[model samples]
Target chain A: MATTKTPSRLVLNGLLNENPIFRLALSMCPAVGISTTVMNGLMLGTAVLFVQVCSSCTIAAIKNYIHPRIRIPTYTLTIATWVTVIDLVLSAYAPEAYKAMGIFIKLIVAFAIITMRLEVFACKNTVAMSFWDGLGMGLGFMFGMVTLGFIRELLGMGTLLGHNVLGFRPLLFFALPLAGFFCVGFMMAIFNYVELVFNRRKKRRG
Target chain B: MARLRRITYLTLGFLLLAYLLVFSGCAGSQNRFIKKTSFRGTHSILITFAGPVDEEWATKASNYRVYEKPDPDIVLKISTIELSTNRQTVILHFEEPLNQNQPHMVTMRGIMTEGKSVGTAIVKVRKLYLGYLFSILIGAMLVQNFVFTKYLGLCVFFGTSQKRSTAVGMGVTFTIVIVASAMMSWFLYQFFLKPFHLDFLQIIVFIGLVSLSVQAVDTILRKVNPMLFKAFGVYLVLVIANCIILAVPLILADNEYNAAESLMLALGAGLGFLIALFLMSSVRERLELANVPPTYRGLPIAFVVAGLFALAFLGFSGMSIF
Candidate 1:
C-alpha cells in the first residue's frame, strides 16, 4: 500500500471506494444533524477538511515521537488545537453557520475519520501523502454531506441555500426528520449504484 | 504515580477552566437575547395539560388566538392539570412576568408534572431571558420534540430495546449522560468559544468532550463497578456516538441557555428522550419473539417499527402539559 503511493487513487478512493459517510459510514452524527442546508454542509465539510489535513500531517510527522500507549492523547491534543482555531474563527465571522452546525463542529475531535486516517494512512505514509489523503477524505465527507443537504433541502423546502429552485410548491414533510432518513437512504443507494457501475466498468476494461 | 498525577492535572485543568468560565459568564446566555412578543389585552393565562390532547381544545380554551397568531405582550400565568391513567393532579409554578395588559395569547405546552397524573399550575415570568429559555424548551423539546419532532436517534431507540431491564437501564443512563454532557458542553461553548473567540472550535470541543467523557466513564466504570461495567459495556461505548447527546448541546448553545435554564432544559430533554426510548424499547422487546420476517430481518424492519412508534409519539406533542 505504501509503495503504491497513488495520489489519484487516494483522491478517488476517498470520494467513492473509501468514502467517509457512504463507504465507511462513520460520523453519522454530523451527516444527519447538519444536512439540513447546503451552506451548513459546505461549512462543516470545510472545517473538517482543515482539521483532517492538519491533524493527518501532525500524526505522520510525529509517528515516531508518539508513544504507542499515548498516541490517542497526542492525536487528540493535536486535533483539539486545530478544532479550537476553527471554532473561534467560525464563531467570530460566521456566527449563524456556527450556531446552526453547533456541537458538530466540536465533534471533529472524535470524528472517526481523523483517527481512522491516522491508523490507516497517516501512521505509515509521509506527511505530504497524509495531507492529500486527508484532503480526499475531507472532500468525500463534503460530497456526502452536500448531497444529503441537497436532497433534504430540495424535498423538504423546495429550496437550495434558501432559494426557491423548484417553484412555489414545497413538500412540508421533506423538512421533517423522516425526510432526513429518506434523503440519507436515497444517497446511500445512489452511492452504491455509482460504485457498482464504476467497478463494473473497471472490470470490463481490465 | 504517573497515572494519578496525569489524572490530577487534567481534572484540575477542567475545574480551573470551569471556574474561569463561570467567572466570565461564558457558561450560558448571561440573561441576554430576550425578545418580547406583542401581548393581547386579556390576561393570557397559559394553560398546559398532561400528555397529548386535541388541538381543538387548546384553540377553544385560548379562544383560537393562541392557535392562529401568538401575541407577545400579555403576561402569561401558565399552569397544568394532568389527568393520567393512575390519578389526577395539578402542579403549579411561576414563570417570568409578561408586560401587563399587553395583548397576548396563551399556548399549552407540556411541563414536568413531577410524576403526577392530574396537575394544575400557574407560572409568571418577568425576565426576558427566562421567557426565552421557557419558549425555546417548549419549542424544541415538547412542541417539536427531538425524538418526536425531528425523529432523530431512533437507531438507539430500537438498538437498546431488546429487554425491559436493558431498556430502562439504557434510558436512565442516557438521561444522566445527556444532562451532564449538555451542561458541560454549554459551559465550554459560552466560556471557551465567546471570550477567547474560539467559538469555531465548538464542534471539536463538544466532540472531544463527549468522547473523552464517555471514555473516562468507561474507564471509571471498569475500575469501580466491574459487574455493572460488564453488563452495559458495549452500550456505554455506543452512547458516545448517540446523536441525542451531540444534538442537545448544539441546541442548548444555539438557544444560549443560562446555567440554570440550561440545566433545566437538559433535564427536561433527557427525561423526554428517556421517555421516548424506554417506551419504544419496551414495545419492541415484546415484539421480538413474535415476528413474520424473511427479507426484513434487521434494520429495515426496525425502521418500519420505529415509524409506527414515531407516529404514537407525535400524539403527545399536542398534550397541554406545559
Candidate 2:
C-alpha cells in the first residue's frame, strides 16, 4: 500500500488482484443475495461504488484527526453515513431498486471491504490513492456481481437482463440460492486458474 | 493533550447535533398504521391482522379495494375473499395476477384489528399467536434458512467452518450475540427510531449497536474463561461484520414485529446460522481428505459443498412445519 502505485494500477488491482468477492472474499453476503439478475447486481454495485468512494475519501481526509481508539467506530459511522445518504437517495429517486435491494443497503455499513480499505490503505495513503483504490474495489465488486448476475440470469431464467433470450429455461437451478454458491465457486476457480497461467507465462517470457 | 481531547469531544458533539437536527426536522413524522402484506402466489394476497376481525366484514369482497401501486388510476377487482382457519388471516384472490415487483396498495374501510374503527387505511400487513410464532421460528431455521436461502453471512459461514469444533463454537457465540443485539435493536427501533422518523439512521445505529455488543462479548469472554477466549476470540470480532446479525433487526423492523416476535426471529436466525455452520463444517472436515482441484483447493471447493448443502436443505421448503 505504501509503495505508491499509479491510480490506474490501483484500480486494476481492485478489479483483478484484490477483487473483493473473488479474490479477498471479504463480503460475500451481498454477492449472493443481490446477484439473482444482471439488473439487480448492477444496481447494488452502483450503490456500493458510491458508498465506497465517498467513505474512502472522507476517511482519507479525516484520518489524522480520528483517535486510534475510536477509529473503528468512526469508520463505521462514516460508512453508515454514506450508506444512509445513498439509501435515502435511492428510495426517493429509484424506489423500484430500493425495494429490490432492501436491507442489503443498510447492511452495507457492516461490509468489511469499505472499512478494510479505510483501515489498510486510506488511513495511511494519500487522498488520490484512496479514491482510485475505492473506485477499483467498487468496480471490482460490481464486476463480480454483474458476472454472477449474467450467468444466473442467462442460464437460470433463459433471459438476458429481463428479456427472454433462449426462449426456454436451460438450467433454472442456477437462479436458486443453491446455484449462487456454485456460480461463485466456479468463477473463483476460473479466476485463480487464469491468474496461475498468466503468472507462468510472464515467468517464462522473463 | 487538551486539544486532542477537545477535538474528540467536538467530533462527538457534532454528530449528536446533526442527529438532533434531523430529528427535529422530521418531528411531523406520524406513525403509519401497522399492517403486514405478503403475496402467496401471483393471484393471492394474504393480509394478517393483530386480532380477529368480524368474519362477515373481513370476508366480504366488497370491503377491500386493490390497486397497482405505480398505476393507481385502475382499480384491480377482487374475485373472492376468504378468512383463514384461525380468523387472523384474510385471503383475497384477484382476477388478474398481482405483479410481485410492483408494490400494491389495499384500502379497507376498517380493519377492526389494529385500533381503527371506521377510517379507510392503506394496509401494509404484519402477525398472530403461539402457533404463528412457532412457524416463524421454523420458517427462518429450516424453510427459509438465512445462509442457504437468503444468502446472508457467507463470509463467516465459509471462514470459520473449516473445522467442526470451531464452527460449532462460533455458532454458539454468534447465537449469543445475535439474540442479545437483536433485543437491543428491537428496543431501540421501537422506542427511538420509529417515533422520530429517524429510520434513515438505522444502518449507523444498528452497526454501532452490533459492534458494541461484540466488544462487550469479547471483554466478558476474555475475563470469564481463557479456554472460551481461545475458541471464540476471533469469531467474536468478525461477528460484528456478519450480515445475519444486522439482517435480523432490519427484518423485524420491516415486519413491525413485537418484542416476542423479534425475539423468536433473532433466535431463529441465530440458530439457523448455527445449524448451517455445523452442517458445513462436518462436510468440510471430511473434504480435507478428499482430492480437491488445485485451483478449487480451499474456498472454491467449500462453496461447491455449500451449494450442494443448499440444494439438500431446500427440500425442507415443502414441509408444512406449522
Candidate 3:
C-alpha cells in the first residue's frame, strides 16, 4: 500500500493489484448478489464509486475530528449519507433503473469494501490521494461486477444486454442465486491463478 | 462459568436438533388443508393449498365444482385447472370469469393430498392468521434460509465460520443485531417513511438504525455484561457488513408486514442464521482436514459446499408443517 505514493499509482493499485472484489475478496455479497445482469452491475458500480469517492474525501477532510474509537461509526455515517444522495438522485433521474435496483441500492450501505477503503486508505491519506484511491478502487469493483454480470447474463440467459445474441437461452441455472456463488467461486479461483502467474513472470523478469 | 456456558450451548443445540428431527420425521404427505381461496380474475378462481397436492386429482376438473353462494343456478363451469409449478396452487379457469364480488362455493370430492385424503372444503377465506405466522417462521428458517438459499451474509458466513466457537459466537451476535435492527427499521418505516412519504430515504435510515443498534448494544454490553461483551463485542462490527442484517428490513418494508409479523420474521431469521452457522461451521471444520485442490482449498471449496447446502435446503421448500 505504501508503494502507492503517487496518485496514479494509488488508482492503479486499487484497479488491479488490490481489486476490491476479485483480489481483496471484499464486498462479495453485493458483488455477487446484484451482478446477475450487466446493467445492474453498472448501476451498482456507479453508486459504489460515488459513495466511495465522497466518503473517502469526507473522511480525509475530517480525519482528526473523529476519535479513533468512534471512527467506524463516523465513517459509516458519511458513507450512508453519500449513499442516500446517490439513491435519491437515481430515483429522481432514472426512475426505471431505480425501480429495478431499488431494494439493493440501499444495501450499498453495508458493502464491506467501501468501509474498508475509508478505514485503510481515506483516513490515513490526503484528500486528493483519497479521491484517486477511491476512484481506482471503485473502478476495480466496477470492473469485477461487470465481468461477473457479463458472464452470468450471457451464459445464464444466453443474452447480452437483454439482446438475444445466442438466439436461445442456455444454462438458465446461472440466473439462480446458487449459481451466483459458483460463478464467483470460479472467478475468484481464476483470478488467483492469473495473479500467481503474473507475479511469477514479474519475479523471473526482475 | 464454563459449565454454565456449556449447558446453555448444549440446550440450544438439543432444541435445534430436536426441532429438525421432529419435523423431518413427520415428512409424510401434507394434509389437504385449504390455505386460501380467492378470485384470480373475472373468469378464474385461485385455490392455494398449504402443501403440494396430488397433481392427478388437482388437474381433474370433475373433482371440483364451483357455484355462487346465494344461488345454485349461477354455476361457473371449470374449463380447466392450471396447477402452478409448485403444484400447491391451481387456478381454475372458466368460459367467463366470476365477475361478481359475491362469495363463491367450491367443492372437491376425490383424493387431493399425498395421503390420498378425500378433499372437502367449503370454499371460504379461512382466517388462518396463526398458520400464516407459523409458516412465515418455517419459511424463513429452512425454506428460505438467508445464508444458504437467499445467499445473504456470505462474508460473515465464510469469514467467522472457520472455527466452531467463532461461528457460534458470531451467529449469536448476528441474531441479536438482526432482530433489533429489523424491528427498529420496521418501526421507522411504518411511522416515518410510509406516513410522511419519505420512502426514498429508507436505506439511509436503515443504515443509521442498524449502526445505532450495534452501537447501543456495544455500550450496554460493555457495562452490563462483561462476559458477553468479551464473547460477542468483537463480532459487533462484522454485523454492520452482514447483508442479512440490512436485507431483513428491506424485506419487511417491501412486504409491509405488521409489527407482530415483522417480529416473528426477525426472530425466525435470527434463529435461521444460527442454524445455518452451526451447520456450515461443523462441515467446514471437517473440510479443514480433507484433501482439497490448491486453488479451491480455502474459499472456493467453501462456496461449493454452500451451493450443496443450498440444494439441500431447496428440498425443504415443498414441505409444510400442516
Candidate 4:
C-alpha cells in the first residue's frame, strides 16, 4: 500500500461524505435525545466532540501495540476512562445538562463511531492525523445534531435556543423521536441535492 | 514475537489506564463514600382491638415488640382477606376511653405475609415480589412500553418487519444487541461511571460504547462469515444506534435497579421491540397490495398505523395481573 497524506480529504469525508448522522448514521442516541432544543443539541455536540477527538488521539497513539484479540477491551477501557472524567466534571458543575442528557451521555461510551475510528482510521494513521480526523467527524456529527435541533426547536416550539423567533402554533410532534425520522429524511434529501448540484457544476467547469 | 509484544503492551496499558481512571475518579470526590450500619433505625407498630387479644398471635408478634390491647379505644383490624389475589382490608375500631370526657390514643397494625414469620402473627398476604414481577412484565410489554411510551428503538422495529422471514432474523439480531448492550452498559455504569465520578460523561460514554461494540461486532461478523453479514448487514448497522438499547440502561440506572431486574428489563424490552416490529411488518406486507393514496404511501401511513397501536396499548396501563 502506498503512503498518502491527505488531511482535508479526511475532514471532508467526515463532514459530508460520511457524515455521522446522515451518511454513516452513527451516534443517533444523543442526536435524537437532545435535539429537542438548539442549546441542548449544541452542548451535547460539544461534549461528544471533545470525547471523540480525545479518544481517537489516544487510540491512534496506542494502535500498533494493541493486539487484535484485545483491541476492543483496550479501546473501551480508554474510552471509559475519558467518559468517567467528563461525567464527574459535568455532574459536579453542569448538573442540569447531566440530568437532561441522562443515559445518552453514558451511552456514548458504546457509540459505534469512536470504535470505528479506532479500528478504521486511528489504527492506521498518525496521532496528529487521527486528532484532525476525529475533530472533523465529531464536528460533522455535531453539525447534523445541531441542525436537527435547530429545526425541531424552531418548528416545534417557535423558538431557537429558547429565544422566540416566530409567533406560530408549535408542531408538537416535531419534538418527538418520530420527528427525528422526518428531519433526517429531509436533511439527507437536501444533502443529496446539494451534492448533485455541486457535481454538475464541477463537471460543466471541467 | 510481534503479536506477543503487542498483546503484553496492550494489556499493561489497559490495566494502568483502568487503575489511573479509578484512582483519579475516586480522588476527585473526597466525600464519596458513606457507611451505613444495620441497626440504624428500627421500630414496630402496635394495634389494639376492642376484644380480647389473640394470645397465640400476640405471643408470636411480641418478638418484634408489636402487641395488641384488648380494651383499647382505637384500633385497625383486617376486615377482608383475599389470599389468592394478595389483597386485604382492615377496619378501624374506636371506643370511648375511661378518662370520662377525654379521647384515648390506640394503634393497630396488621402484618401480612405469605410465609410464616418469626415476628407478629397476621393473615397471610402473598409476597409483592410476584406482584412486582407481574407488574414489571406487563409494564414492559404494554404500559410504559418500549415502543409506545418511550418511542425508543423504532428503527429496527420498522426496518426488520418487511418480510416474516426477515422479521424473525431481525428479532433475533435485536435480542442479541439488546442483551449485549444492556449488560455492557450496566457494568460500565456500576463500575466506571459511579465509582470514578465520571457521571457527567454518561451520554458520550454510552453512545461511544454501543457504537464501538457494534463496530467491533460488524467487523468480526464480516470477517468470519460473509454470507451472514450480507444477510443482516443493513439491519445490524441500524441496531447500533437504536434508541431502545441505549434507553433501557438509562431507565434501569435511573430506577436504581438491581442486576437481575436490569436483565429482566432488557429481555422484556427486547421482546417488546420484537413484538412491535413483527406487528408492523406484517401489516405493511398486506398494505403493499392495497389501493393506497399517492401522498400517504410509505412513511406517513406507517406513522398513522403506529399511532393506532400506541392508542390500543394505552388500555393496558391500569391492569395488575399479579
Residue-by-residue lDDT tens digits, candidate 3, B1-322 = 5633753574466346434533444322333487677666567878888888888888998888788766878667888789998888989899875744355778767556786775576664222445556677778888888877777787778787788876776776676677778888999999989999988778778888998998887887687667767865777788898888888998999888876667668767888998988988899999999998777878877877877888788788777663
Fnat for each predicted structure, in order: 0.14, 0.92, 0.65, 0.13
DockQ of all models, two decimals each: 0.16, 0.64, 0.53, 0.11
Per-residue lDDT of model 4, residues A1-206, tens digit only: 23544777777878888898766656654554567787778777877788889989998888888889867667766776777777777778999988887666665665667767777888788898998899888888888888999899888888887777887737977866546555665665566667678888999999
TM-score of 1: 0.62
Which runs of model 2 end up more than 4 angstroms from their true locations?
A199-206, B1-128
Docking quality band of candidate 4, CAPRI definitions: incorrect
- Total clashing pairs for each candidate: 66, 6, 3, 45
Root-mean-square deviation of candidate 1: 12.9
lDDT of 3 at A184: 83
Candidate 2 lDDT at B93 equals 91
**Which candidate number would show the highest TM-score if scored against the true structure?**
2
Q: Is the docking of candidate 2 incorrect, acceptable, medium or high quality?
A: medium
Model 3 residue B304 CA deviation (Å) reads 2.0
lDDT tens per residue, model 4, B54-107 = 333333422222113333433333222112111222222112212211112322
Give per-model CA RMSD.
12.9, 10.9, 10.0, 13.3
Q: CA lDDT of A54 in candidate 2?
A: 95
Model 4 reaches what TM-score against the true structure? 0.63
* Candidate 4: clashing residue pairs, number: 45
Compute each candidate's TM-score over C-alphas.
0.62, 0.76, 0.75, 0.63
B207-279, model 2: which lDDT tens digit per residue?
A: 8899899889888778765676787687787897788998998898888877666767877888899899999
